[model samples]
Target chain A: MKLTDTFKTAIIGLKTNKTRSALTMLGIVIGIAAVITMNSIGAGAQNLILSRVASMGSNNIFIEPGPWSKRMEKGSMMQSMVEEANITSLKREDAIAIANHPLIEMAAPFTMGVGRIVYLDVDKKSSYSGITPDGQKINENNVILGRDINEDEVKSMAKVVVLGFTLKEDLFGEEDPIGKIIRIQKTNFRVIGVMEEQGVQMFQNMDTYAFIPITTTQKLLLGTDHVKWIIAKAWDEDRIDEIVSDLRLLLRERHSIYNPSGDLAKDDFKIMTQKETADILTSVTGVLTMFLSSVAGIALVVGGIGIMNIMLVSVNERTREIGLRKAVGARKKDILNQFLMEAVTLTFLGGVIGILLGLTFSYLGGVILGNMLDLKWSAPLSLDSILLSAGVAIVIGLVFGIYPARKAAELSPIEALRYE
Target chain B: MAKTTEVIEVRDVRKEYRNGAIKTDVLQGISLKVFEGDFLAIMGPSGSGKSTLMHIMGFLDRPTSGSCNFRGKHIDSLSDDELARIRNKKMGFVFQMFNLLARTSVLDNVRLPLFYSGLKGKEELELAKRAIELVGLTDRSHHLPNQLSGGEKQRVAIARAIVNNPEVIFADEPTGNLDSKSGQQIMDVLQKLNNQGHTIVLVTHEKYTAEMAKKMILIKDGKIVYNQKVDHRRFAKDGFEK
Candidate 1:
């Protein structure tokens, strides 16, 4: 039999019962749609996070004062992630050394503490970070009023502060408050600048902060010689790994750690470049996408079973028709091909509809999610996903359609004709 | 005298059905020859195996023992697919229930056999039209089966049967579901086709219907009680009354 003829016959059979055919296709439609939606949303989320990370200047690296435990070398990969050392060994000298490197643009040693600041009668509690003018520049914190603290202030251990926009609003309120005296931790300090309006960056709320010189913060507020963390900006994008290795060697030599081998666990500090952070975030979202996609794959399997169930019912219902066809000289393969083609056509059509629906839904979903999360969503639907879904739909049809088609083909004409 | 060609021949064919070891012999040691251009009817009461015998002869069922041959080929020796090919090219069937596909137009229903005959669309359409014209359903060729009358539906079945221009036609209780007027019209159509030189094996319970055929057999309890030529045949005359 010609494939076209068999296809026509299959179409006729399906058209005879349109409601059932559509209902049977719904399962496949939903399955493919779910898979595509999951993939699209995953891509959109990855884009949002990666874009956010890139906005923080790709050359920046964050250094935290935490040494890995000696057990890291013998432990699993995940176990080596534990790196909260109790000893505060990171000093301001380490930041200065790192800042002097040829590849380093600037290294800002920063320490933070929460203190009550009394300006006139307003006694407000706020978090303050002690960093230099270089730290303010690298973080994109532009001083809109007055002047930023210079390197001379750090050498003189000057007790001066810069107020963030929201903090200035809370403390001074519509008044030009630069050069005004504020009490922090029972010590008097003059506000040198008011920074421009800055919101959250890298999960840190930047608007409600007050800044002081790192030496003044270490000597007066908490009375410690150690700095908490340092932010390092590279001179250029290339050879970041070399700079990181050099920083590790320099720190190891200064701190007198005797290990010659470069083990990250033995280092006194943990450094993560913005790219590494973005990569980790991407891998995490990738796992989530894969997990959700597997769930959608289950839906496809269930849809295949739905096709099988409906095909079996159709075979039972059309016993007499099958007998009549056989009597009229339909070979077993002809009958099988007819029924199988019916199923494949159904799923393939459903796959097309599903791809369109999935794309539309994902586009809408990206917009909705972007509005809710306050981030720009740029998830582009990929051709690989479309082709993958189309192929899956056809395969499900063949896998599920085979049994029922075989049953119809193997029917004895006499028995089928006589079937009531 | 010219010798007749045996289109189908059976030698002591037995068809038994086993229901959990309880055997029922539907056709018991039956032997027969169907000649080309022959209109033969096997008439019997219900459960007398007339339909089973016709089915065996028509290659619809296999015998439990003995041999049945069609066109010098043993029925048991041919594969099901090979038999299906033969049936498609050389055989046609008309059932009493008028098994036309529901929701399909008369033309497509008639064209079904040709669909499997591997004919091109144009040829299939032309042959189906000719078959429908022969069955006198040309006017109703585009009508769905549900829209057709009982008599018209039977005519559509006849059209489907002869669409492939088979060498032989099998009619099992062709008029059993129709009124007497429609039955007379159907018998007339069959007789006209027989006259035009199509070998026919018909199954019927009605004695009057059997008499219209050139040869008749009476099957009683899985065995042929008697076989003879019809002496008086009734034709579907104008305003014919039974």
Candidate 2:
């Protein structure tokens, strides 16, 4: 028989028992839907993280005051606590040294603190960062109003601050707040500039910080001569590795941790390039997606078993039909093909419906998440995942259909015809 | 007029079925011959093994200890697929239950055997229509089996049997489930096909039904007790009596 004829016969058989066929397809439908939903959501999350990391500036690097292994090694809680007290070892001079390197374009040493800012009747609590003049350039901060802090401001330890977009909105709310004085802690500082709006990154709202000159912050606000971390940009992307090595050499020389064999555990500081951070984020999300999809795959297995169970029952119910076909000149292979085609058709229909349902759910989910996280969310429908899921469904049909098809083919026409 | 070509020839055929420790001999070395254009009826009581012998003659069951031939070719030596090909191309069957596929239209029911005939769609339909017309079911081709009366259902079965233009048709109690009127209509159709030169082997327990055939064989306890030509005068005369 022609393949089309076999498929047609299979279709007729399924159409005769429409309710039973649909019920048999339920497991596969849920399984495929779960798989597609997880795949799209996982891809969307990875894309969001990648774009956020990219927006933070791919050519930039971060240098923090701690050994690389301090956070990674187990049972180092006491060691990290002791190290945290002396973390003030990285001074502003080290940032200047790294900035002077030919491979480095700009460097800004900064520290973070949370404080309340009072402007008129509005007093809001927000995070504040101390950065130098070059911090605006390295962090991609654009001044929408007024001027950024200059070299003279840093030299004079000027009591001026730049408000983040969200902070400006909170205190002023559609009013011009540039040059307005805001009280930070016990000191009063004039807002010199308002930074352009930067959206959420890594789940943290980027438009919420107020920036002040590092010199003023260290001298008057923090009362510390040391900075917490240094952010730097490379002159060119290709020279990032060279600039990182130069910073590592300069920081090690200045900090005087001269264990020169480059054992990262013994080093007093950690330098991480933007690429390294992105790679770490990718790996973390990748593992998380894999684990989640595997849990969803369990549903697919259950669905396949359901298909097999229903196929066996169908074969039993249609024994006389099988016998009639055989008596009327149907070969064993024909019988097998008919039943197998029925199974494939069932799962294929289920897969198509599942994909549509999965896509719908994913789109709705993306919209809800986008609203909650305050980011633009797109439904991530990867063609590869769709194709893979379809392939899995077909293979499931074939594998599960085999035993029942064989049972049908192996039946004797006499016995089957005689079967009540 | 007797046709010289033998459609089926069975020799010393024996069929024994085993169920674990119990063994029952269904047919003990039975032999028979059915020629082309022959309308032969095999009659016996229940459990007489006539059905088993008919099954073996039709290549539906393999005899345990003898040879069966179709058109001078040994059937026991043929593979299962080969047997299926022979059944599809040269043999047709009608069952006592009027074994039309449930929920299937009369046209499609008649067209079932032609699916294996490798005939193109239009040609298969044309042939199916001719067979349905032959069985006087042209107006009822689109009706399902459940929607038709017992006689119409049996006619649909007859149409299905002849759609492939098989050289022989094996009918096992083709009218067994129908009333006398429906049974007489089924016998008339079979008689018309036999007259048109198609060999038919019918299995039945009714003596009147057996008398409609050109030859009759009576089997008792797995052995043929009577094999002879039917005397047309001994049976009741009907309007279309030969």
Candidate 3:
């Protein structure tokens, strides 16, 4: 028979049993929808995390004390906490020396202290950061209310603090936070400004913190010049590695340490560049997303099996029709094409419906995150995700539908004609 | 007969089936010839191989040990595709059950044969309409097969069979599934087409229906027993029972 005639027969057959065909298509539709939705959600999360990391200043480098510092020969527990007392490596003077390097644009020394912040009647546990005037530039924090601490204020030991957006909301509510007094660790400090709303950064809420001048924090609270870690930015985006290496060498030389190699087993301090941190986060998120989609793939397998089951039933029901067609001069190839086309058409329709539903769900996901967490959720619809889902659906349909279509096409006309 | 006028020739066709290990011979050394413009009926009891012979003649089944030649061409040696082409273009088939596409309208059912005939353009529609009109189903053209009565469905099947203007029309028990009135109406339609010089071959068990043919051949045990030509004018001059 003519190819057109065969296709016409298939279309008429499908039209005659619309409900059965639709139900068969439903299995593929749900499978495609699940695959597409999972991919989109996974893609959205990765993008959100990447951008948040980028906003924290892509070129910024982080240097924190590694656990190996406690294992040094002369290290007591307290001396290990203070890298300078270990006398084997890194000191606060090393951070200043690195900042003085030609490739380094700015450097900030940080010492974390736990304190309850009190404003009016409410008191909440918060971390206090002691930063140089340049720390604001290094961390990409720009004050939205008043102003960042000036160099003069840091040098003169002013007791002024800049509160993060969330800290301000808890301390002052709708009241103006600028020029307000917030007591930290039994010491009253005047609020100079409120940082803009920064969402989660590296798993820590950025909002529930306050920044104070490093000299003032050291003199008034800790009574020591020791700092927990140092953060620095390169003069240009490309020189960060060079700056980190120079800082490590300078600290090793000044502390009279023989070995300069940074073996975690022997090193007295740890210095992590921004590249390393971002790489860790990216790999973490990448593996996480892949794992999630793989879990969702089980649903797709079940759906593909559903399609195969229904198509087998269709072949059984249409045995007589197949026999009549063959007797009327339809070639076996023509019969095969007709059934294969029906299978593909079912999957293509399902893919379209799934894409629409997935996007709608992704949009709703973003809205819910934005309202509940006060975090701007940016889950964009990715085309690669949609195309990948469609390709998978087509493969599943063709692979699963082949057996049944072949069964229908290979039916002997005489035998099928005799089938009641 | 003229040398170039032979419409079909079956030369010692043999058919056999192996049921498990035992071979059953269905058609044993059968030979026949049908000329153009002849109306022949094959009469036989069940298992007499009339249906098997009809399948071979219609190119739907292959003979085991002989040749089926149509219009001087060896159809038995043709490929499946070639056989299908010949069946689509040169042969028409009317099955006992009416075999109309159940959900299709009478017009589309008539158009079914034309789809396989490799015919297109406005001429295809015109020819289909003319065939439907010949079957006296022009007014019911848009009605589906299920909507039509038994006789009307049989007429639609006939129109579909003849729509391509085939060289020979094969009806295997064409009225076997119909009522007496519908059966007579169908036989009358076949007789009118035969009068128009179209060749027809039918298989039937009913003697009354077999008498409508100008020539009747009876088969028993895979062999022709009685072959005779009846003058229908003799019946028309008297009554059908005479």
Candidate 4:
């Protein structure tokens, strides 16, 4: 039979029973939709996380003390200094040493203190970060409206503060706050600059916090010589690990601590590399997306089964038709192609509709999740998701469609016509 | 008899049916020959195996024993593909119920055989259209089978049967489902085709219908009781008197 005529007949047969055709296609539609939606949402979450991490800095390594290293070093159930040695040993001197290392470009000592800001008629609780001028470069903090504090400000112990972008909007409204005075606890400091908006990073919003010189903050606001933590940057991408190791040795010597030096097996402070963090993020996101897409793939399998089942039923219902076609000289291949084309058409239509629906769902879902997470919602749909889902649907159709088509084609014309 | 005019030949054709473990014989060593341009009819009571015999003759069923040849080719030994090719290109069929694909247009019903004949191009479509027009259904070509009258549906079936210009056309009780007027019209078309040198084999229980053919074969209990040529004047006057 002519291919066009065969297609026409198949189409007419499907269209004759519109509801049955739609019900048959429903499984495929749901499967494609679920697959595409899961993949898109997973990709969106991954993109969001990577941007959050990138905003922090690719060269920056976070040194968080780990429990395993502390336990290995102390070998005790309860020890006070062991835990403190593990965490608090990451101090301002280590930051300066890392900064001065041959492989290091820049680093900053920073301490964070929390206090209520009171001005005229407004009072709000906010984080106050004490940082050197170099911290600005490491954190990518840009002054949107006012100047940032200079190195001279830190050296002279200037009693000046820089407001984060959001904090300025909250405390000063439209008014210029660069020269205004804001009270931190009992000490009032002059605002030197309003830092640019840095959205939100990890758990802190740089836009909401105010920056002051580390020395002045240590003496006046925090009331101790100790700095909260140190943030460091690498001069070159290749020398990050070498600089970190050298900085650790220098800090150990300067502190007169007798902890093993190259003993990550019994380390005092933990150092996590940038590549490690990136790998962890990629692996976690990959695993999450795979898991979600597998569930969607299951739906596609069930949909394929649905199509197979419906086609089998159609073969039964159209037994007489099959017989008639065979009698009129339809070859087995022609019969097979007719039914296979029907199956593919059903799935292809379903896939088209599902992609559109999935894109819509992803957009809405991203907005809802973003609002709940308090982050910017930008879940752009991936074209790969649409194409992949379509490809999957077609494959599913072909795989599940073959058996029933073969059954129909293998029927004997006389027996089929004679079927009661 | 012309040596080159034989259209169908059967020799020692035997058929059997199985109902679970028990077997029953349907056709017992039957043999027949049909010449081109002849109108032959097989008539029998129910359970005489006339339908089975017709099926074997029409190539719809293979005989259990012996061979049937179409245009001197041993059809009994041919593969299903080869058999289908033979059926598509060499033979046409008409059923008692008209067997037009319901909900399909008259033109499409007529064009079905040509579609299977592997004949492409506008020429094939025009041929199909001409066949429908020959059946006086040019105006009703677009109407579906259900929308056609009994006589019109029969005409459409005739058109379909002749569209491929096959060597033989098989009609099983062509008039069995139609009223007398429509049945006569159908028989007239079949007779006209026979006169135009197209061989036709019709199966029927009605003597009046069988009388329309040039030769009549009667079967009883899966056996041919009588096979004879009828005089045209006598057949026109009163058909078989039983």
Candidate 5:
């Protein structure tokens, strides 16, 4: 029979029993929609993480103290002496040493502490970061008003601070706060700079911080000389790996640790590049996407089974019609083609509906998630996902449509015609 | 005297159907010949194996140990697809229940056989229209089977059967489900087709319906008991009630 005629016949059969066909297609619709939604959400999350990581500056590297077990293993008296000799740990001297490397562009040693700030009638708790003047350069902290902390200020341990945009807005409102004095834990400090509005990065509001000179924070505010972390920028992106190895070796030598290849957990420090962080995020998101898609794939399989079950029922119900068609001149292949075509058409229609619904739901879901988490939500409907869904729908139809079509085709004309 | 050309020939056909370990012999070595342009009826009581013999002769069932030929070609050994092709091109069938497809227009029902015949486009439609006209159902071409009367449904079935212009038409209990008036009308239509030189084979237990045929055969059990040319005087009045 002509393929067009077979398709027309199949369409007519489905049209005649609209409710049954729709019910059969429901499984497929939900299955495809779930697959699309899961994929879209997974891609959106990965993209959000990627953009956040990118905002951190690819050439930047961070160095921090290692696990506390390594530090506590020393005797209590020795630990106290080690703490007092902050230059022996991650300190300003190490930052100066790293900054001297030809491949290193700049390095800033920083320490963080929580402090209550009072400006006239307003008082609020905020994170106070102490950084050198080069911290602004390495961390890409752009100043929109006044000036940044300078070397002379750091050397004198001057009580001066830079307010983040949100901090300035909260304490001084619309008034210029660059020359104003704010009390940090009851210590008065002159505001040297107000940072530009940078918004959120890595899930933290960068606008809510107050920055001071590292020496001032370490010696006066924090009452310690040890720095918490060090930020460094690379002169060339390609030399980052070499610079990291060199820095690691230099730190190991400076700390008098032999066998640098030994267990890294025993090391007193940790160094990380932006690429490593990005790779970890990618793998994490990849696994999440796989896990979610598999869960949705189960729905597709159930839907396929539904199609098969309904098709078998249809074959049984139309036994007499099969007999009549055979009697009129329908070959076994004709019967098979008709039933198979009906299944494919049913699933194809369901797939189209599923794609549209999936896109809508994914967009809605993205909006909700974006609002809750305060991140940009772009609809992640990739062409590969759309095509893969369509392919899966067709395959499910063919695989599930086979058994019933075969049964219908293999029926004997005499027996089928005799069936009540 | 000129000899008639044989359209279907059945020789020593035996059919046995097995249910588990039990076997029932439906047709025991029955032999028959159907000629072109002849209206022949095979009459028997229920379970006499007349329907089995008719099924074998119509190529719907295969004989266990005998050979059947159609138009001088041995068809018992033909593949299912080959047999289907011959059925599509050379045979027509009308059933007791007037098995028209439900929810389908009468015209599409008639055009179904031609779908596999490879007839293209307008030509297939014209042939279907001619067949519908032959069955006198042209006005109800677009109506579904449920909208038609019993006689009209049978006529539509007949139209479907002849839409491919087959060489022979098989009617199995054609009026078994119809009233006397409708049955008479069905018999009249069969008779008129026969008069127009179409070969027809009918299977029924009604003596009045068999009386309208040019030749008749009576079967008892699995074997034929009487085979004779009908006497025209018995059905000359054209109505069974008279």
Candidate 6:
């Protein structure tokens, strides 16, 4: 028998018991849909995170004052929170020493502290950052309303401050905040400018921060000279490796570490490039996607077993029909092909429906996730996902349908005709 | 004396069935011969092993210990696929149950054999239509089996049996499910096909039905009791006698 006829006969067989056929294929439909849906949503989420990481400038590197612990391997927010109290290893002198290199753009020593800001009658607790002009440049911040604090201010130990876009709004409420006096830690400081609106950077909401000169933050607020971390920008993107190694050697020489073994575990400070941060985050999302996909894989196995069960039952139900075909000159191969084709056709159709359902579900998931997280996300349907789902569906049918088809082919015609 | 061409030769054919430790011999050393263009009937009561004999002779079942030959090809040496090939090219079968695929139209039901015969779609359809015309079911060609009368269903089965133009047609109790009127019509159709020079083998318990065939064999308890030409061979259209 030709493949076309076998498929046609299978279709007719399925049509005869429409409800049974539909129910039999339902397991496959749900399985494939789940697989595709999970993968699509996973891919969308990975893309969103990678893009956010990319938004943190690609040529930037972070130098934090810690003894390079595994828990604080990268410059995640936890590093700064733990590094702030007594780690006096990083300072303005370190940034000054690193910024002298030809590959170096500028390094800014920075610190974070929370305090109540009082501007006339309005007052609220907010976090503040100590930044240099170079820090503002690396942060991609442009003072939209007024002038930014300059390098002379840092040398003069100026009390001038730059207010974040949201902080300015909350403190003044549409009032002109530039050159206005705001009290922090019971000391009056003039708001030099209102920084431009920035949503999220390095997983921190930058809109909620107020910036002060690093020296002023060290001398006045905390009465300490220790800085939490340093931010460095590289002039050349291609030579970031050489710049990182050069800074390591310079920082070690400045700190006067005598050991020349070059062991990272013995280092007093940890340095992380943007690439390492991006790679860690990418691997995290990759593992998450793989875990979810394996869970979906269980559904496919259950669905394939469902096909096998139904095919077995169908073989039993049509015993006499098989017998008649055999008596009428059907080869065992012909019978086997007919039944296997039926199963494969059923799953292929289910895969198509599943792809459609998965795409729809993933698009809706992306929209919902976007609304909740306030991020711009798109769920894309790639050729790889479609082809993978379709191919798996075909393989599932073949793997599950072979036993039943072979059983039908091996039946004795006389006994089958005599079957009830 | 002119010797006829023997289409089938069964010498000491035996068939047995085993259930657990119990053995039942269905066909015990049964020997028979069928010539080209012969209309043969094997008749017996229920469980007398006549059906088993017919099955063995039709190549649907293999004898346990015997030499069963068709056109000088030994059944013992032939593989299952080889047997299927011979069945597709040289044999046709009509069951008592009519065995038409449900939800299938009459034309396609007749085309079942040719599908396995490897004919192209158009040629299979053409041959099916011709066979349906021969069986006088041309008008009902597109009607499903559920809509057909008992006699018409049997005629559809006959058309299917002859659709591939086989050398022999095997009918196993074809009239068992039909009324006397319908049974007579089926016998008439079988006799007419035999007259057209196709060999026919019929299995029936009814003496009147078996009388329509040119030869009869009676089997009792796995052994043949008699094989001879029909003395008063009856015609189906003359009104069957009990």
The Cα error of candidate 1 at residue A51, in Å, is 3.7
* Candidate 5: stretches off by over 4 Å: A67-89, A112-128, A156-158, A170-175, A181-190, A215-228, A260-263, B233-237
In candidate 4, residue B90 scores what lDDT?
Answer: 77
* Model 1 ranges with Cα > 4 A deviation: A52-61, A68-89, A110-131, A136-228, A234-238, A256-263, B238-242
| Minimal lDDT window, size 10, model 1 chain A | A72-81
Tens-digit per-residue lDDT, B115-176, candidate 1 = 88888889889999999999888888889999988988998998899888888999999988
lDDT of 2 by residue, B1-242 (tens): 54478878989888888999999987787788888888899999988888888888888888899999999878768998888888898898999877788888899999998887788999999999999999899999999989999989989988998999999999999878987777778888888888899999999998878888889999888888899888872222263232
In model 5, pairs of residues that clash are none
Q: Which stretches in model 3 have alpha-carbon errors above 4 Å?
A: A1-8, A67-92, A111-115, A151-158, A200-205, A215-229, A251-265, A370-373, B1-4, B231-242
Q: Across residues A124-174, which tens digit of lDDT does each residue of candidate 2 receive?
A: 898888888788777677888888888888889999999989999999999
Each prediction's whole-model lDDT (CA)? 0.87, 0.85, 0.77, 0.79, 0.86, 0.87
**Residue B121, model 2: Cα distance from true site in angstroms:** 0.5
lDDT of 4 by residue, B19-73 (tens): 9999989888778899988788999987788888877877777988988988888
lDDT of 1 at A287: 85
DockQ of each: 0.81, 0.76, 0.41, 0.59, 0.78, 0.76
Better of 2 and 3 by DockQ: 2
Per-residue CA lDDT of candidate 3, range B147-220, in tens?
Answer: 99998998988898888888899998988888777787888888888888789998999787788888888988
Residue B235 shift from truth in candidate 3, angstroms = 8.0
Question: What local lDDT does model 4 show for residue A320?
Answer: 80
In model 2 chain B, the worst 10-residue window by lDDT is B233-242
Question: For candidate 6, lDDT tens digit of each residue in A258-376?
Answer: 65887776777878888887786777677778888888889889989989999999999999999999998898999999889888988888888888887888888889988887667
Judge candidate 6 at residue B140 and give its lDDT. Answer: 100
Clashing pairs in 3: none
**What docking grade applies to model 6?**
medium
Instruction: Calculate the i-RMS of every candidate, to one decimal place.
Output: 0.7, 0.9, 2.3, 1.3, 0.8, 0.7
The lDDT, on a scale of 0 to 1, for candidate 3 is 0.77
- Candidate 2 lDDT score at position B172: 96
Native contact recovery (fnat) for each candidate is: 0.87, 0.69, 0.29, 0.47, 0.73, 0.67
Error of 6 at A127 (Å): 4.6
